[model samples]
Target: MNCEVYKGSRKEGAYLFVADSKSLENLPAALTEQLGDLEFVISFDLATRTSLASADPAEVMASIKTGGFYLQMPPGKDLETC
Candidate 1:
């Protein structure tokens, strides 16, 4: 499956992945509001073995399939407390 990637303006390194481009109707309003502005990153093929920076491609695809979207938040700042 192909997926569209969007970067969150409010948070650095935050990303949103959806099954379709410009399709946010299925996502909750609260999530959209929290994400602020979105910038298109790129379209990716989930069927292929493509590596992501901080998330598993397989998990992302699964989320998109089940929830219509996948949220990838930035890594925690402090590992000691995590």
Candidate 2:
């Protein structure tokens, strides 16, 4: 698995690249363990044109305040190099 994280306007959001679907399924757990101090939520794709997975920035931050984290992995590069 390959993962990179960037600080959002309010909290930490991670972008993950998994080699396959199986890896993707396990991503949440992997991230949770990696981000020891912070709480992690679901992953989002910024590049997504649809609103299916869209999340409010304020809500994301709010979740973090409660010890939860949010993740976003837009479609682009492969996890191998990311």
Candidate 3:
């Protein structure tokens, strides 16, 4: 699978993981483990605006300072064209 990491900005911060159907199931656990050391961390479905809306401000800020976050894209997404 191909993966792309999106670093957030102060005005609109988030980690967006886009994957094909085959890789979607594993995203949550993988993201959790990968982000384990971060503070005030949480994950939610990308399809819902409310989910992203609930992100903790403090956590987002911390993540921004700590090199931001990563988005795991499915294979064939071709991030270079995105």
Best by TM-score: 1
lDDT per residue for candidate 3 within 1-82, as digits (tens), equals: 2223332232123344332223333445645444333222344343333233444444434443443343433344423322
Overlapping backbone residue pairs in candidate 1 total: 0
lDDT of 3: 0.37
Off by over 4 Å in 3: 1-14, 17-52, 70-82
Q: What is the lDDT of residue 13 in candidate 3?
A: 35
lDDT of 1 by residue, 1-82 (tens): 8889998676676788998865677788877777778889998788885787888899998899888898887677321221
The sequence of per-residue lDDT tens digits that candidate 2 reaches over residues 1-82 is 1222332232233342222233334446655455434333334442332233444555444444343444553445222322
| Model 2 poorest 10 in a row by lDDT | 1-10
Q: Would you list the clashing residue pairs of candidate 2?
A: 39-68, 39-69, 40-69, 41-69, 44-72
Pairwise lDDT winner, candidates 1 and 3: 1
The local lDDT score (0 to 100) that residue 36 gets in candidate 2 is 39
Where is the poorest 10-residue window by lDDT in model 3? 3-12
Clashing pairs in 3: none
Ordered by lDDT, highest first, the candidates read: 1, 2, 3
